[model samples]
Target: MSHRPKTAALIAYAEALLSPEGQRRVEAHLAGCEACRAELAAIEAYDALVEDVRSVEIPTIDFASMELPLAREAEAVSRQMIAQRQRRSARPWIAAGLVAAAAAAALWWSTRETEPQAPPRAEAPVEREAPAPVIAPEPARLTPVVTLAAGEVRRETADGEIPLELGAVLDEGARVGTGAASELHVRLADGTGFRLAASSALALARAREDEIRLELAQGSVGHAVAPLSNGAAFVVLAAGYSVEVTGTRFVVSALDGTVGVDLSEGAVRIRPPRGEPIELEAPARWRSSGGAEGGAPRPVSVRGLEAPRVAPTPVRLADARMIRWSVDGIEIETSGDVQLGLAPGEHPVRAWDARGRLHTALLPVGGAPVELSAGALQADAPRVRAGHLDEADLRPVLSRGMRQVQRCYELALRQGTGAVTGRARLRIEIGLTGGVQRAQVLGIPESSLTECITSYASRWTFPPPGGPLTVEQPLTLAPTQ
Candidate 1:
């Protein structure tokens, strides 16, 4: 028996109104049966014709005679069937009844044509009420973009450290950092600008369309907030203090155990862990030395900082045994107090206490010596040092490196000789400065491309380590068309 689909099945398939299993059956039947295929095509054409007719506007329809043709056609077909039955059975009454019905239909049509026709009347204008006004919805907010990044800057993600570059997009919960001699600048989608000072870290706690919150982990950040909409909030948080502002230009710094809020322009409210919130206007400065101990904030001068001149100076310290000092990146030994001739300028000074806590300060020198006391130092968060790269640390680096290599391989696929598909091993040596000191490819064929890959890997930098270290990574590249 032929397994062709019926007309109804073909129409259902054409309209896509069949269930998945039914459609599959119809499709299978149609594939082998040319007759079913022809039927489906005809059904589709009929559907299209019906849709076209529905779209056309027929200005006038004569409902008075619309059903007359249908009735006449039905009667004619009935009469023909009755006449055929009468011929077989010799029924005279059926023939007479069919002839009478035919004569009545003909007389009705004749009278309908002879009757006088009336003139078509014009339709009255339609009274359409105005449509309701449509209100457009607000546009969606976009993620913030990095407008500028200078000096040494990097972003620490769950995966690994990614060097910050201009035009980088920062999402919420991103942690950004700048090195000792580096600085970073960023702008939000709303045109608010942030300047991050050296050796500083800032985490984007939240960045929404209506509100923005940033947490300063260490160092200072200067913000030039733009005008915001009503109910909008911009907040900066530190370990012991929070600064809330609607729109303002200010600086927030977390140094040692002290938190400082300096307002360059506009106004902001500084709320400490304890004590009344301190409100400051433009050109005002407030400093709190003791965190959580309820340190009173006092107004200070709004003086601009100048670059210090270089000169040999004497260094004074309190409790030298409890601190290890470094001047201009050089470790210095001080027994109580020492006199050393140094360049006159802003010097980067770092001290590590006996408890392994690191403190950073800037020493300005010209003619007189610099004095550093324990109370004036800014202590940073504690650091965890490991002898070698742990699995946790190594995983992100591998993942990030693999992504970089994949990008490079994709470029190679567009620009190079053949598809590179193999596994390559790299042994990299990292310096204490968090830079790749050396990179060597092992177990891979020596070629210019391999050297280029090594060169690319050598540019990868991580956070500075407590000591120099070496790590080996294996990379697998798949063939790209």
Candidate 2:
């Protein structure tokens, strides 16, 4: 009927072998139960005593003292047995033998110790150091922003080249390229605008808070830089030259191992591969040929010529020979001479002589009448057709023709006495056989370059088209710098 814990419960509590709930219950009971507490204390003392006994060495027994009692008892038992045997029969002898045996067993039981043995000590748990904490490296940070893209443009990234949409974001170190007859317009986060012409390749070298650097591998680019904070640097690397500008509008062209820069507004500093830095202002141009040797900037004279009073005035050739004239890129029919009006900008006027030789002249019209000679025309220039001709359809042919003409032009520019500057327009007529049937050049003078370009165009073959095609294209040579 007692509510106190049993001896087994006390042992369980001492060894911490009870469940959490049972231990809590036993602890609560012990707090108000004095009897259980005393019992637990006695059990703990007994455990301590057992441990002490096991730790101490056993002493040698006093064999003489132990043997004397057993000897006296054995002598008494013998004397009684002899006395009984003399007085009674053999049954009395048997009873005395049993008595002596009982006495010996009692003596042995009284000599032994009454304490319980201690349990074996458990082996200490093997200690193992916890594995070192795993530390992970921090990830790299990247800043990317969306920019404008147009016309067969693609960006080269870590995953390979991806076609760019109108507002695709580009990260630092992204390389952008454009196909033939294609162009790209992009604006940076800093409001700087970049216009890349066809067949161009550019790499965004760095885009950071303090600077934005670009590398121009080939072709041309126009930069319209916005105002910048002090110490902000905008640099462009092209061929063997480097262009550094704070805030300006300029054009950088890297072609045929030469780098040319034309400043339209503000000023820029050009650093050649091996020469002193050359500073240029608006309306000035400079070029270098992949070396440290720097060249002087040349002034581009913009004469404000007047527009003609009459619209579509008579264009009379001094020889009065039958010829064809084109305003802009459109061919015009004429019996002996052609009558055309001049516009307020540079107009590419082309003429075809009787022998089908092409001549071109770029007429800068301000507000007056302008005249051009037949020899000032260039023939067989590449042109972009109107309508929805797929760039894929036109690129291969146009690219090939332009490349041929460009080589000839570069050669002539290097060797010819006169400066080969200004824009030239070429009107090409592809025949049914994919050969150039008739080619005319506009806005450039008749020279070895023109003749060479025409001869090359005449022999050039294009992929067969759905029909005969007419293409008029304008080519601009970098001005002397």
Candidate 3:
């Protein structure tokens, strides 16, 4: 057999083994391996030799076309045939082509198969569902043990101390910002129980019975009975008032040298100076010229004690001998001495306890007293048109000789995190030495900076030299994103 290559090499070129005319060339080669590939390089060499031979005073001519002698032409034809036969053999290129074709097919098929799936294993994480919603616990339903904090005092439920630093616990969720207040309700290791709400100023007196008793030394405090008992009693010692609590939750606020008690649902009795008693049923209030006999309100703690009962039907503020008691609801009139009436329930009474003063105490029957008193007569300052005021209306820093007077420019506002919207323009008059200092926004939600400014040129009185004038702009804040 002839040393012939297989058609796969042609197919490899036809597919790998082929070109545009590669199939025809391959078929022809298959038909006759004798016509395998002819080498043009040797033919060109023969043409150059013919040129050299004829260049001697003559032009070149095709030696193959010339009618040369028969023996010489035959010899040349045989030699050309031999050279063509030699070129037909592909001893070198056939082996290399087979190896290259095999490698190319293997590589193309291997890479495209399954490699794409591997990289996708590192895809982004899928979102997970959020946990279930947590219900805000109901105050009335918590287990008695869980109702109070391990060490929460004064208020209802206290977890780790409240975010608030100093606060007076009025009722369950109700409280006031006493100048300062601290509360604790810690469970004892032995299962014994203790609770405390230190007033801005505190006083502790001996107690009796299952009741919690505290003497209002010179301040006021709120207390809850031990172990979630209903009949918890506390004492409030304020400037000119004293109170004895029975079974209930109440808060006593001592401010400006006075004590005011507000009962949420429990009963407390107002004990005026000299051990006089004025009973306050739930929601009743009782206030006096002072929380304690001779001092400002102070916190009093009386645990495990009975509420001190007045032997006789105690004399109340209605029976204030030195300070007569006469009232038309909140507005009370006193001539020579101060008049006080301890209403039935909680009340925030405002009293004008000046030598010749009248106080308006809006007593909430059994609540705390809201007192409103007039300072020494203040002549009314002139008022200006609201549109005529501007930032210059702010009081000028006083100058004494070469010295400059300075005061803290406080931007007073309601400290809260909730948002509130405004629907109307609100106007407020800030009180000053003479009269209205600045007219500003009240109860209208706006920019805090805008409230600090005046609509026109205004004059204000900053007392002494370093004190600030209060801006009576009411604001509201709400909770949102």
Candidate 4:
């Protein structure tokens, strides 16, 4: 206690690998020691550098082309020696005397090889054309431009680090990093682009025509890749694995020794360093347990609602511990304030408090931006102005009805649309004494699933609201993982 913590202990503490008691001890010391805290920061920085080095792309080499010029030079020298031998062979006696003299000359030359020799006489030197210069293959036409830079984003180049601005073209090997709460978006000349999340580091490792590789050392990225030409590939290297895709919309993350991939559309092949490659299709999720070979992807039961094809309205929300919203049945989750694209309708909004309790609100989206406050959601209050249902009372009732929701989705999946996956919104009106007053389905196309859900929901009961209370519920349908 009187001395300082060792380097190994500090490392374990930084990685959160120490026991709870050890963590408490280290933290207590850190609270009083600035030098130890600085050491811990340096340790984390070095670890990040090592992760970046691991994601570097190894360039391919063509050995045949490199050796061609040397091979030709050796061949030319051999031909010149043959011609000299032929000239000497025409005079046999002279050639025999010269060969005997050459032996003694060779013996003398061996002993003097280490000594500095005099320059060749002007006429004694043989002239030869310099070997043709080796021409390198042309580099790929990869031009990436910064499309968006939000908050504190910087790019590292040979000329040193610079603040990344809109329209700046990124050079290959350049690394981009985002500070906390910052994000960055970059688009390639080929219509491929990616959005980097906060507190992330990514390197544009390679940009050859045959292959384009992005190295992700930390955080997450959402990518939209255009279809590549024949024999071309797009790859994302993260942690110890690589994701290769021709064209796709997906999300990849390399954070805290964990790597994950969520494929919304298109197909991809993931390769681990020591295992066989994994193939993934659309609407699937893959995660690894701190190693490329540790885990596999599974199909997700839920997916976010797709933004409307046409111009959709944007809804903004206030900061919260966690905010979840659903429009037309698709739900999305994020922390802090964010803008969401929603179709013209009334969407359900949910936010969590510090103690993890849910608060609910109804946000109407039309044209102008609508601002929602998590602290203002009153739908969950136990006695809300004498007409509302409290979140504490609503959550348990919905939880008990999840079986009906699953049943409806499973029945619909069996009805020849097995591959179909989407979200559906259900609207229910509860009357006094917890009676179901009305039930309706919104957002999803009308089908047997909708009919089944509506029929089951109308008969459900909940704790009594003083008066009429209407709420929207979200349901997601997908194949079993």
TM values, all candidates = 0.33, 0.33, 0.22, 0.39
Off by over 4 Å in 3: 1-182, 186-199, 207-211, 226-236, 274-276, 289-481
Clashes of 2: 31
Q: For this target, which candidate reaches the highest lDDT against the unseen true structure?
A: 4
Native-referenced Cα lDDT, model 1? 0.64
- The regions of model 4 sitting more than 4 angstroms off are 1-132, 158-160, 290-481
**Per-candidate RMSD, Å:** 36.0, 42.8, 39.8, 31.4
Q: Write one digit per residue (lDDT tens) for candidate 2, span 241-268.
A: 8999888888888988889897877898
Runs in model 2 deviating more than 4 A are: 1-147, 290-481
- State how far residue 54 of model 1 sits from its true place (Å): 49
The per-model lDDT (C-alpha) reads 0.64, 0.62, 0.36, 0.68
Cα-lDDT of candidate 4: 0.68
Candidate 1 lDDT tens digits, 1-481: 6565588777778778999999998898788898898888888888899999999998898764645566467646644543333232222222234345655344334333231221112221110121222323322233555543444578998898888865466766889998764556566644475777778999998776677889999998888787777667889999868999887788898988678887767899989999899888877777786334233332221111111122134454444544355665434333233223345567777767677677887877755656666676688776545435557765776678777766666766667642667887888887777678898877766655566667887888776665678888887767744
Model 3 global lDDT (CA atoms, 0 to 1): 0.36
Each prediction's total of clashing residue pairs, residues at least 3 apart in sequence or on different chains, is 8, 31, 85, 1
